[model samples]
Structures are given as structure tokens and as C-alpha cells.
Target chain A: MATVEFVEATRVYPGADRPAVDAFELQIADGEFLVLVGPSGCGKSTALRMIAGLEPVDAGRIRIGERDVTDLPPKNRDIAMVFQNYALYPHLSVAGNLGFALKAAGVAKEERTRRIRATAALLDLEPYLDRKPRMLSGGQRQRVAMGRAIVREPQVFLMDEPLSNLDAKLRVSTRTQIASLQRRLGVTTAYVTHDQVEAMTMGDRVAVLREGQLCQVDTPLALYERPETVFVAGFIGSPAMNLIEAPLEDGCARFGETVIPLSRAAARAAADEGATAVTVGFRPEALELRGDGEGFAITVDLVEELGADAYLYGTAVAPAVSGRIDATPTVTVVARLAPKGVPRRGEKVRLRIRDDAFHVFSTKTGRRLPD
Target chain B: MTATPPTRCASLPVSGRRSRRRGHAATGWLYASPTALFVLLLFVLPLFLVLRMSGSDWPLLAGNQGINVPDNFHEAVSHRFFRDSVVFTVKYTVLTTVILLALSLGLAVLVQESTRWKGLLRTSFLVPSALGLASASLLFYVLYSPLAGPFADLMRSWGFTFLGTPEGALWSTIFLIVWRYAGFYMLLMLVGLQSIPDEVYEAARIDGASRWQTFVGITLPLLRPTLTLTTVLCVTGSLLAFDQFYILTKGGPDNSTITIVQLIYNVAFQGQNDLGVAAALSVITLLALVIINIAQIRAFSRRADD
Candidate 1:
């Protein structure tokens, strides 16, 4: 087990205008499960590959444990990787696949067999040990891939969206299995995925990336509650955080005629940026359904029901409810509500964001406002 | 990602589905009738005629006289060049198959490299295959000539002639064949190599496999199907070796390079002028080819299963 570090690592593909992963820097503590999450082409996988030494560190250094291994090959990095496609040797049986790294290291026959068998048992793959990879189902193939990495018992584990190939139900179950397995093995692991929920649930610390740059890295809850940028606030949540452009008043942010009181620090931050408007944000669950004509009114456009809870997606008229005589546009918004009393489509519902739940950011910059 | 579930096949009554399948079979036969007729007229009819000729007293000019049966088989087996030709053909087939497969595999790997020279290397290596075998053999005939060949000076310096002896004759023919067909076999190998996903190699690299280990463990095994195909083609082509030998040596150098097909050609049209013996020799060669191909496929697949 080793701590993996990336110090200002960058990768630029040939003929490309920009670096695919630009100045990426992070340190994964020993035994820590760090997830690199982003949208497609966001350089999350490039960052993980850099640590595994699969990709060259063009501009900076990477260390595994105490070794500076920027120029080392993947095999010498003491890392095991589980590819998204599984990448199992289609010709080899499960046992052979599991023992490949051990055999490569010239492990004795008896010890190789023992390690393979143990890994098979751990992955519930003993029954399939004699079967080639194609003979197994997708979930089984995924387990064999994991077993191949586990049998190596390397200093670090690198997984690039390993569960992406599985069906939805299997992905959920295997997600927990991988988290628990990494904890049990106490191996430093860097997992890359575009699934925000997977990153939130499985990572010891989640590093959010966008357009080849780190936006934020924090514990899941901390990232959810205190996202450092407007991007993180919008990206980290399911159904996403509702961020609306609102004109700043004396000390408040406005939504329609609903005046949201902001912290003094937030107003000061907006003033410091010399911005006339602030982006007020709130999570879907932070919205409270008030009585008619009590708060900001939104016309319910759609409702997504999920057993116990439901989400109301609607469009609320933007600004100028105070009769400025200028034209106003409608901004789409989302709010989580109880399934039992969920309003139907086209119903106008008054909603209020909790006083402490508002996330304020300056309009001139995408950075989050203080407090 | 929420992928759509696979659509279930529509169910039909067993008898109805069976009738539908029968209708499909009839349509398939309808579509295949032209090709079937072509094969019958071209291959099957000629095969049956050969068999008939082999079992009868058929002379090249006089046509069939009477049933000869075992007499033709006996004469074919007892021909003076029969034993020597069979032995030489087998030797050539074995040598050609091994060398062609190994050299083509090496070429395929070289051409498959991601270097900037890949296109140039591939095109240059494959250029010789564009030449016809007979034409290539004739080309090599001039190249092997002591008076007119480019290698005349080099051969003089080395004090060795290309087609002056039995061993030289055999190796010169082999060289001509390799130059002509090496690129074709490498193309087959390259197709097989490209089918292997790149991720598998990355996985092997992370497994700490050395270059030699990866080739032995991953590449060779996965390329087994292509190897079997190329081996069968090389062996069969070499066993039917006629054009190059005929054009170059004419089974000379004490007839040390006589091949089965050349012997059959001699019996049918040149010296013996007996269609029965030629037909018998052809049947034997065809049977041997079938047996060898079956044995080769079985051996490779059995190892794959293990």
C-alpha cells in the first residue's frame, strides 16, 4: 500500500489545442479511496492513468510511496488496474487471469495457485475459475477483473469506471462491494467515474473535475454542502442544485418577488466583485412548499415520482415582479417534495428556500460567495 | 447509463414457426440454386469424370476403352517419379508452411507497429504479392540465371550457383515463393492482430508481463484461428507446388525437386500420356489434402480447448 501523488501533472495529445489534463495535482493517502469524477472528456481518466503510469507525466512528477516514478512503466509502478471493459484475456480461464500478475512476477506454482484460489473465493468466482471470460455473464466477468487485480495485491489499485459495463442493479451491488473490499485490503485506490452518485457513495474523498481542471476535492458531504464554485454546486447533486440569476438588493437576493435574506458575508462578497446581480442557489430538497401567494410561485411543468419522494420541475417568472415594466423571462427550477402531496403538472405552487440553505455566488465570477 | 432492454423475440405456434422456417429454407435454396449449379458443372461433374477415368482404361488421345479400376491405381503408385515426388512434396510443404508462417508473423508484427513508417513498410512488403505466381516464378528464373541475373556477380563472388544443385534448386524455389506470397499471409495475420483489443495489452503490461511473455501468452493463443487458416493455406499451396518448379527447374537437378502435381501433369499431357494414372494421382493428392487439413484443424482446436 502506498500513497499516490500527482504534482502538476499535465497531458496534451498531439494536434490538440489544449492539454487534456492540465496541471492536475492531488495526493491520495495510503488506504484512501479517492474518486475522480467528471463529465465525458473531462480528463478524469487521464489523471488516474497518470498515477498508474499508463500515461506519461509530461510536465510534473508522480510518486507512489516514496519513489519518483514519472518515467517508469506501468508494471514497475506496483499498481493494478481494472479497465472499464474488464480487459480480461479472453483466451485464459478465470484462474489463469487471476494468477497472471503473480506468474509474471515468477511466483512459485504452489503459491500462485493459493493466491488465485483465495482471490476466487473472495470474489465468489471459484465456480467459474475453469471458465473462459466469454463464458461468464457480465457481472461475473467484472468480478474476474476485480479478482485479477486483487490477486496481485499491489501497492495501489486503479479502476477506470469498472462498473460502467454492468447492468444497473449489478452496478449498485458491486459498487458497495468494491468500497468494502478496498477498505478491507487497505490499498490506496484511485477510481474514475462520470457517475456523481457513485463518486459520492464510494469515495473516501471526492475530487470533482471539469474541462481538465480540479474544481473541488472534499468529503462527499462537505462537497455537497459547501461546493467552492458554482460549477460544483450545479454538478454534484442529482436533479442538481437550482441556481438562478437574481438582482442583488440592499442586503438580499431576489427570486420573483420573494426576497431571500443573505448573510452579510455573501452580500459583501458580491460587492467586492462589483457585481449588481448574484446567483442564488439551493438544493432541490432545500425548497419548502408554502401556502398559495406566500412565496415565489412556480408553475409545475413536470413531476418525477420515486416511491417515497417526488421532484417538481417547473418554470418561475424571472425577476421584475415589482413591476419594472421591462420584459421578464421564465427560469426553470426544480424542488423535491413528498410523493403523497406532489402537485400535478401545471399547478402553481408557492415555494420558499430555507434561510440558511441559500448558496450565493457573484454573477461576474463563477466562484461561490462567502458564508 | 440506462440502456434499453433487449426486445424479446415474438413467439409463434410451434407448427407455424416450423412451417415458416421451412419457407425460409426454400427461399435460401432458391437464392443458392445458381451457385449450386455452377459448382455441380464446374467441380462435381469434373470430379466424377476424373473418378470414372481413373477407374477405366482411358488414354489421353483415345478416350475410355474399358474398366481398369485397380490397374490404374497400381500403375500410378508404381510410377518411377511417384515415390520421389511424394517425398519431395511433403518435405517442401512442411518447410514452406513453417517458414512462411514464422516469417509472415514477423512481418505482420513489424507492419503493425505504430511508427510513422508503418504505411510505407506495409505497402512495400505487400507489393510482391501483387505479382502473379507464374509471373513471379518466371521473374525469379531470370534472376536465378548465372548469365543474366543480378545476383550473378554475388553468386560468383560466393562461388555458389543458385540452381546448379538439388539443395540450391529447392531453396531458390522456396525463396521465390516467400517473396511472392509472404505479404498475403502477413495481411491475414495483420487482420487477426487488429481484432485483439488494445485494452488487453494494457492489462498485460500492468500485470508486469515482459514483451516475450505477452507475445507467447496473449498474442499467439488469440491468433490461433488465423494461424490455422494460414498454415492450411500454405501447406495446401505448397503440396500443389507446380508453377514455380515447372518454370524454374522443370523438375531437374536429377529430378530431386519433382512434385506430385508436376508428375500428374507429366502423366496426363507430356511423357506418359495416360489420363487414368493422372486422375488416380490427383485423387490421391486431394484425399491427402483433406486428411491433412482436418488433422491440422483438430490439433489446433484441441490445444485451444485444453
Candidate 2:
């Protein structure tokens, strides 16, 4: 187990105008599995590489278990990494590939063989030891790569989208296998992926990055329930959290002529923070389709019905501010309903908002309003 | 003598010509005929001529005689010059092959590891390859001029004549050969290096492999195919070396630097102009090359299979 501390680590590629990873200050607890996730070009992979010492950290220090390893090479840091491509040595047999690192480290031949066999059996690769990487299937090759890393038994593990190359079905299975493996090993791991689902499901704490900056760092439930910023709120959930811009008046938020009663604490916090407009976000599941009133008049544009639940995609056409002050055309909301009673396209529906489920953020700053 | 020209020949439609598959086949053959003709005339015909000449003892100018078996095989086997040239060629081939492989592999590693100024170094390595061997020999001859040359003073300072003796000339040629051909091998090796994905190196690094260990275990093994190819080329080229020795040494002091090709040239064109013996030697050289290539191919394929 290792405590990885990135004390204001920054990575700037030479001659680039902006840093690829800006002062990323993070502390990963011993035995903690932290998943760094974001959209493409968000610098999550860069941060992981920096931690692995594959990429140099231009400014700041990195420590692994009380040892400052900022300037140390990957081998010196005693860390193991599994790459996206699996990166198994094509020429080496499965056994050879697994034992190569140990052999390189001058471990005895007998011990190397024993550890290789143990790791291979752990990965269910015992039958394939004598076979070369070319003879192995993709999934088997990935297991061998994992086996190679596991044999090292290093202080930390770094995995960069290791399952991204697998098929969808295989990805799901491998995801569970890798999470269970990490848990059993109890090694501090920094996993990098663009897939939010993998991050949410696997990470003890998911660190969301946006443009080289940490947007939010929390458990999946906390990040989903109490996103601290607009980016996080919009980024974390599937089908995305529907956000609408509306003016905030005394003790309430106004959408067209409809005035919804907000919590007194939230209004006071917004007022105290000098917020003029508010962005309201609600999950699709939290919204219920109703029949009448000036609630939220939405014409169903598209209806997607899964087996258990269905979603109604519609645009809210209300005369809201439609300028640079608030450019979005009213609002587009996705409502979740049971499969048996899903809405049809072109059907006008009124959405009954769950007030407690609604998340309010300041228009100017996009910071979450505490209730 | 025409039996009768068909009147339909004139009436044959242009559309009929367009539809004819024979015309397409004729066009395809027309494009291929030049290369086919050249190969037949230069390669196939020369091969037949060599085979015939190898079995004969046709002296220079025929000498009012017919072609017959000349006991050239006995002469080739017994002659001291033949033995010397064969030994010298084998030595040169083995020495050059090993030296070039080692140097080129090092250069390949350097080129692969380098970041800045790599283009400049690569171009410098390739510059010598562009020069013809004969021209390069002449250049070395000038550089080796004892009266007034850069190498002369340097050799003097180092207490050695770099081209004054057979050993000196052999080493000078080896140096020239390495300088000229290492870059070509480096290019091949660089392609091999770049083809190995960065992920592989990262994986090795994370697996507790030191840079040296990775180079030996991973890099070397992966580069074997390219290394094998370059080794074959180097060995074959060294075996067939002639122009530089002919220009720079002309068999040197005591005929010590004469390659088999140089000996063949001397037999056919110098003194007696013994074409029969030269042809026989050429046949032997061809057989040697074939045998060497077969051995190398077997080794290469066997490793690949393993």
C-alpha cells in the first residue's frame, strides 16, 4: 500500500502555451483506488502518467509513502502500470512475459518461475504459459499484462484505460474482475479513463477533471447528490442533468410566469452571495409528467423506452430571457417514467418538478447553492 | 503466297476490337515485355554463358582452339592466389559483418533514443552511403596519400600507416564500409524500433525492468527480424566486395588484400586472360553465395518458428 501525494504537481509540455496538467494537488490514501476521469483532452491520462514518472512533473513534488519520488524514474518509484493496449511482449511466451521483470531485477530463476505461475493462475492463464502473445486472444493478452504487473507486487499500480480496447461485454466483465483484483491486492491504484460509468462503479473516490483542473473529488453518491459545480452536475450522470436558466426573485426562482418556491436557506445563500440568476438542474428520474397548469409545458420530441424505465425528451417553450443573458431556448428536459406508461412523441405533457431533487447553481459563478 | 485475305478484316468493327480480351492481354504483355527482355538477355543469357564457360577451357582469343574442359577446378583448388583470395574474402566478410552489425545496432539504439538533433545525425550517417564505392575508394586513396594528407599525419601521430600495408588497407576499407552501410542498417533498425509501440516500453518500465534490461530482453528480441535481414545483406555484400580493393589496394603488398572478385578480375582481364578459370571461379562464388543464403534462411526461419 502507498499514499500517493501530488503536492501541486504541474506538467507543461515544452513550447506549449498552456500546461497540459495544471497544479494538480491531490492526496490518494494508502490502499485507496482513485479513478481520474474526464472527457478527451481533459489531462486525466497526463496526470496519471506524471504520477507514474513516465511524464516529468515540471513544477511541484510527488511523494509515495513518505518518499519524495518526483524526480525518480518509474522503475525507481517501484510502481507497476498496465497500459491501454495491454502491451504484452509479442515475442515472449506467457510465462516469460510474466517473469521478465523479476528476472530483470535479478530474482532467482526458481522464485521467478513460482511467482509467474502464481500470478498466471490468479489471472486464469495457467494453460497459456508456453504460448506466445500472438497466440493468445485479446482478453487473454490483457490478463497477461495484468499478470505482469501483479507479479511486480509494487507499492502502487497505474492503469491507463486498460479495458478500453476490450469489447463492450468483455469490458463489463473485466471491469468487475479488475476492481475485485485491486480490492484483494489492496494496492494504491490511480486508474485513468474517459468512461464515467467505469469511474463511478470502480473508484473508492472518483476525481473528475476538466481542462487540467480538478472539478470535483468525491464518492459516486456524493458527487451525484451534491455536485459542487455546474460542470460536475452536468458531467456526472447519464443522459446528463437537465439545466435551465431562470431569474431568481424574492424567496423563489421564476421560469417565465411560473414562480417555484425554493428553500429559504437556498434563496438567502444566493442573495448573500449576490446571485441574480440561477441554473436549475434535475435528473430525468426526478421529473414526473403531469397533465395541466403552468408547471412546465413540454411537447414530447422523442421517447426512448427501455425494458424497466422509459425517457421522454421534450423542449420547454416558455418566454424566458433568450439573449446573451440567457441564450438557451427555454429548456429541454428528460422525464423518466415506467415502461408500461411511457409518453408518446408529440404529446404535450406537464412536468411536476421534485423540489428536493432540484439542484440550484449561480448563473455567474456556477457554484452550487446549499439548501 | 497468301491463301486469300478475308474481306471481313476490313469490315471488322472498332467495337469488336474494344470487346476483345486478347487486346487487353496483349497490352499487359506489352508493358511487361521490356523488363522480361532485359532480364532474359542480361541475367538468363549470362547465366547460361557462365554455365557453359564453367565447363570449358576456352583460352583468351580462343587461340585457334575449341572449348574443352580445362582442369580449371584443379587449378582453382591448388593455386596459392586462389586460396589466398578465398581466405581473405571469408575473413573480410566475417570481420565486416560482425563489426557493421555491432556499430549499426549501436547507432540504431542511439537514433531511437535521441530526441533533438536526430535528423542531423541520421543525415550525417546516410551521407557516406550516397557515394559510389569506386568513388569512395578514390577518396580514401587521396586521404591515404602519404606525402600530403590528413590521415598520413594522423597515422604518423598514432604511429601507424593506415594504408601503407595490407593490414592497414583492410582496416581502412572496413572503416569505409562501416561508415557507408551502417546508416542503411540503422534505417532498417529504426523502422523496427518505431514499430514497437510506446506502451510496450512503458509496460517494461513499470514491470521493474531497468533500461539496460529492457534493451537486452525486449528490444533485442523484437529487433531480431530486422537484425537478421541486415546481417544477411552485410555478409553478402562483404563477400562480393571487389571495386574498393581493386582501386585502393590492387591486391596490395604481397597480394594480401585481393578478394575473390578481384582474383576473378585478374584472371579474366589481366596477364593470360584465362576466361575458363574465371568462369569456374564465378560458378564457385555463385554456389558459395547460394549455400550461405540457404544456411542463413534456415537459421532465420527456424528462429521465427520458435
Candidate 3:
């Protein structure tokens, strides 16, 4: 129940040219569930390991509560971690695995047994108290992993994709269990996962990382609505936001005949930044199908139907630009549609962007244009 | 109705599958027959011959005479040197097993932690295992010599005699065996240590376990299978100790280092050449080993169940 802070924490493997995690700076508040999310090799796990003190912090400092733990070992950090593989001691029974830390910390045998029994009850693992980890199902093993961390009553919890090994249905249920468990315990936690959906659903604040750098740290809705960079825009949401490179013309971004009107502030910001082109992003639910001659025509490539809603993945047809050879490549646009009137593949559909749902970023720097 | 047709089709392949399995089993036996034949000829035949010889009045120079039966067993049990050798074998087995397991486990942990020159150290440690036990024993014999060996001057300077006394001979032989086999046993324990996932150690570290606690709580328990294997090997190998003691001490300094195998060899070849009594001693040693091995296996399996 203490705040954890990473002040420019960086890690560079020996003989590697670049740091795995470079100048990482984040302050997790007390009782906050901060998730580090990115694709593989993005150093999200490295950042979490650094905070856990499992990884050496080659440079910079990390503080747990008020103590500098950069040079300290993991044992002195007073934190507990749930590994991705649920690394339960295979030889020990469930009770032994749960009470391992308490015993190591020199708790009396009686107290250790009491705490283990309490934790087993909380995890509904009473029946499995005498069973080995190999005998438990994946979901039960996952709870045991969580119980291992909870029994420590440490200052923070570090979970590295704890639910990744469970099946899909189990993963969903366990994700909620972990989230609510963290809330009930109110321990400051730093969780790392590559799955954006998991990060969006479980994190109080999601920090999206790319190429060993933090792209954006914000609430899930903020990240979905306004991603600071093109990477975060594409990485934060399911089915991802559609980004189109369009030319800036007449205070609007133009992609062939499809002219998306930008806010005055965005246009001014683009002009101020001296950006001749802009990358416009819109979510799948931000577009509506229209009649002919009213919107951009798209040739539907595929349709994914879910009970209530469907998504149309279509390649936008390049509209001829007058007196200009339109060299910009046509990009695919994904738009959500009502399940009732979903378009079939190879059919043409007209789509119009919602009034102010577009996110405009400069093409040169890939930074969001202020609006 | 639809399932009945599929069931009829499945039944049609049952005989074909069984014949194919029988053919596969035949090929497996065919592949294994050569080794099986070798074992029967080399091991089983000799075992039966020894058992038969133990019950007959067999001598080395003369052929087998009439049945001796319990006479050879009584002579072997009553022999003073034979009793002393059995006691000495038990002592050596217990001492060497304890020392070898402890030292090899320490060496394995040391090598596992080292990131630098690990291969060089491992190769250096395992190089002695490559030398035959007789060859290593002979080498150590020269090293233990007080007059013409490399360590002669050093031993003289330190006022120490390596194999001049019974305790010296015993420890010297134990040292030789440890040097020869510690690396091999270390490699076994190393495999067990490496197979433990790195995440387990990390979890223990996060659990605030000290290094010693980690070793006791995590490493020792997880390495139980390897420990059992190395313990059995060390005990059995030390119990059958003959080459090293024969080459180095020759039951030296008042016959204090006579192991059971050395006594059996003496009775069969050096003494009055009593092949019957030697065979009887061999049978007794084999029975003891079987009993010890069964007890060891039972102990390990019971612990595993718990």
C-alpha cells in the first residue's frame, strides 16, 4: 500500500546497442492499478521487472514509498509478483506454495497455517490444499499464483500477464477476479500485458509503450478517443482505429474526394507545425453508411458479424482529383454497421465520417494535432 | 441409425489395427534382441555360474568337486578378514556417500551461479571422470608416494604422510574416488538445478527468501530426484570399491582398507584360491546391495508421495 515511482529507469543488456527500456518514468499512486501494455519486444515487461527489482536498473532510480530500491535486491523491495506461468512449486502442496513466503519470512508455524487456510478459503482452494499444482486446473493454478502474492501482504503487486495461460473463458472471468481482488486489497499494482483489451478492461490507467518508450499514459477511454501518436491510436483499441494519410487542403484533410473537415484549432496547429499532410484517424463506430454521392465509396472486402453489430472491412475507392495525379495509395477502412443490414463482400458502400469524431495528427512527426 | 453405420466401419478396422500393433511390437523386439542377447550371455550366464559355484566345492586350480552347500557360506561368514572387510565397506560407503553428495551439490551450485568460464570449469571438473578408476587410482598412488612423487617434497616439507596410516589410506582412497566421480555427479545435479525455471527463483526472491532459505526451501526439495540418484550411485559405487583400494593401498597397513570386493578377490585368486567361498561372498554382497537399493528407492518414493 505504497506509491511506486520509476525516475528515468532504463535497462540495457550487455552487448546490445539500445536499451530494452529507455528512460522510463512513471509514478504509480497508492492503490492504483497501472497497466503497461504494448506488443511483444516493446519493453513493457522490462519496465515491470525493473520495478520488481528482478532486473537491474542500469541507470536512473526507482523508489518504493520513500526508499530508493534501485540498488536493492528483489527480496528487500517488499513486493510480490505473480509470474505469467504461475510458477508454483511443483513439489509442494497448495498449502506449502501459499505459505512459502510466510515461512521464509520466519512466521511461526501456527500463524503460517492460519494464513494459508484463510487464503485457501478466499481462493476456494480448500479442497486443493493437499493437492500439488500439477493436479489443479489452469484456473485453480492461476488463483494459487494470485494467492501466493496476496499472502505476502507486500507493498505492491506485480503481475506479468497472469491470466495469459488460462483459456479464453477462464481468462475473462479471472481478469475480473484479479481486478476486483486488487480493488478489495487496495494494493498499488503494476500489471504488464500485451493484450490491449485486457489493459483497457482492467487498468485504472493504461500506459502504452512502443520501442522501449512510453507513447501515452491515460485512461482507457482517453486513449481510445485521443491517442497522442499514430502507434497508440492503432494499438489501444480492438479492430484498431483506421488511419488515412490525407493531404491538407482548404482547412480540411482531403483523401481523394473525401474531405474531412477538421476543427479550426487542428487546422491552425497543422499549419503552425508546417505539416502539408495529416494522418486522420477514426474508430470503426465513428462512421455511418450513406446513400450514393454523399460519402466516400468503399469496396467491402470482408464482413465480421457479431450478434448485435457487424464490421465492414473495405478498401476505399480512389476518387480522381481534378488536375492532380492522385498518387496517394488507397487505404482500407473498417466501419461498424448494424447487424441487420450488413453489406456482403465485394459490394460497394458509401460511408460518412461522424461530425467531430476524427483524430488528426501531423504526418511528419506523427504527433496529434491540437484541437 | 447414422451412428450404427460409423460403428460398423470402425469395427472393420479393429482387426487390422490389432495386427498392425502386433507387427509393431514384433519389430520393437527385433530391434532389442541384440542387446538382450548380450545381457543374457554376459550377465545372466555368469550370475548362474557363480550361484552354482557357490554351492559346490570349487577350487581355482582343481575343477569343481562334490557339493559343498552351506560349508562355503559358513566359512565366508566365519572368516575374520571377511567380517572386517564388510564392516570397512559399510563405513566407507556411508562416509563417501555423505561427502560426495555434499561436495558435488556444492560444486554444482557454484558452477551454476558462475557466468564466466563455466564451460572451462565444468570441463576441468569432468576431465577426471573420463579417466578409468584404475588409471586414476594408479595416478594417485604415485602422487601419494613419499619418495618419488611430485608431492613428495611438499608432503615432506609439511610433515604429512598421505597413505602411511590406515586413516590416511582410507581418506586418500575416498579423495581419489571423489575426484574421479564428483564432476560426473555434479553434472547430474547441475541438470536438475538448471531444469528449475528461473521464474521460481524470482518468485522466491520476491517472497523475501534469503539465498540460504531459497536453497533449503526450493533447491533441495526440487533436486530430490537427482539427490536420490546420486546417493544410490555413490553408495553402490563405494560399496563395490576395489580398483582404487587394490591399486593404491592393497588392503594396506594392517589390512585396514580391505573392502568386500577386495576380500572376495583375495579369497578367489591370492589366498588358497577358494572359489566357492569367493562366490558365496559375491552372493552375499549382491544381496546386501539389493536390500540397500530397495530401501533407498522406498525412502525416496515415500518422500515423493508426501
Which tens-of-lDDT digit does each residue in A147-248 have in candidate 2?
888998999999999999899999999999999999999999999999889999999999999988898899988999999999999999898998887777
Positional deviation of residue A362's Cα in model 1 after best superposition, in angstroms: 2.5
Task: Tell me candidate 3's TM-score on chain B.
Answer: 0.90
Better of 1 and 2 by DockQ: 1
By DockQ, the candidates rank as 3, 1, 2
Quality of candidate 1's docking, in CAPRI categories? medium
Output the lDDT of residue A140, model 3. 94
- Each model's DockQ score: 0.73, 0.66, 0.78
Model 3: share of true interface contacts reproduced: 0.93
lDDT of 3 by residue, A138-219 (tens): 9999999999999888999999999889899999999998999899999999999999999999999999999899999999
Ten-residue region with minimum lDDT total, candidate 2 chain B: B1-10
> Residues B152-223, candidate 3, lDDT per residue (tens digit)?
999999998899899999999899988999999999999999989999998888888899989998999899
DockQ of 1: 0.73
Q: After best superposition, candidate 3 residue B243: deviation in angstroms?
A: 0.7
Indicate the residue-level lDDT of B132 in model 3.
Answer: 92
Model 1 residue pairs with clashes: none
- Which parts of model 3 have CA positions greater than 4 angstroms off? A272-274, A318-328, B1-28, B153-160
Q: Taking the tens digit of each residue's C-alpha lDDT, what string does model 1 give over A1-371?
A: 88988888899878988898999778999999999999999999988888777787779888899999999999899999999999999999999999888998999999999999999999999999999998999999999999999998899999999999998999999999999999999999999999999999999999999999999999999999998889999999999999888888898887865788778898887787777778888999999899865669999999999998899999998874342365767889999988888889989888988768878887668888878
Candidate 1 accuracy as TM-score: 0.94
- Give candidate 2 regions above 4 Å deviation: A256-258, A272-275, A325-330, B1-31, B63-74, B151-160
Error of 3 at B78 (Å): 1.6
Q: What is residue B274's positional error in candidate 3, in angstroms?
A: 2.1
